[model samples]
Target: MPKRIMEGKVVSNACDKTVTVLVERRVTDPLYKKVVRRSAKYAAHDPQNICQLGDQVEIQECPRVSKRKSWVVISGGTGKPSEKRIRAGQDAAVEAVDTGKIQPKKAKKADEETVAEKTDDKK
Candidate 1:
């Protein structure tokens, strides 16, 4: 039989040579006959440390590499282009925020001013 393959997002890549992938699928409920989304996490071997958080990847069944890792990251699958663009955009945003290039807008305290006016009127 051919090895099983699954597509999922890399939720965690903190472990050395291993990443956690969250595979989500829709299944019809047996009793209700309604389609329900379900997800399972699998530990896949990532030898190159290439996968990052939120990276979508393809995992293939292989001989057990560890107690929990029986799958290997085969490819980026359908997530190659989007992943690179997202990561690049995120990195740029982070740098901009960190260097004070993009300052977040602060909300004016109009509510506070109104409360102060009410307190003054009562006094």
Candidate 2:
């Protein structure tokens, strides 16, 4: 029998040598007869750790490598975000900070000052 192969997007790569791929498929609802999207996450073995988040990868069924990982990454890098796109996102975030559109966390010194004021008020 032929092994099952699937294509999905890598949603997480936090585990060492493992990636979580999210596979989405459209199925027709029996009662409503409308098409609906269904998705499932599969833990795939990534020996090389080449797969990155948001990358489109092909996974193939294989003997279990771990408790939850039964699939292995066969191919990837087709849909990985480009360096320019990532840099653009970082630039946008910096611009937001510079323009005061996004407020960053307060410094520890400010927290200390607030704590001192509270103590003085109590006294």
Query: What does candidate 1's lDDT look like per residue over 53-93, in tens digits?
Result: 88778899999998999999998734343466679999999
Model 2: colliding residue pairs: none
Question: Candidate 2's residue-wise lDDT over 1-123, tens digit each?
Answer: 899999888999999999999999999999999999999999999998888889878899999999999999998754565455568999999999999999867669888999999999999
> Each candidate's lDDT (Cα)?
0.88, 0.89
RMSD of 1: 8.5
TM-score for predicted model 2 compared with the true structure:
0.63
Q: What would the TM-scores of all predictions be?
A: 0.64, 0.63
Error of 1 at 40 (Å): 0.5
TM-score of 1: 0.64
Task: Give the least accurate 10-residue stretch of model 2, judged by summed lDDT.
Answer: 77-86
Q: Cα lDDT for residue 92, model 1? A: 96
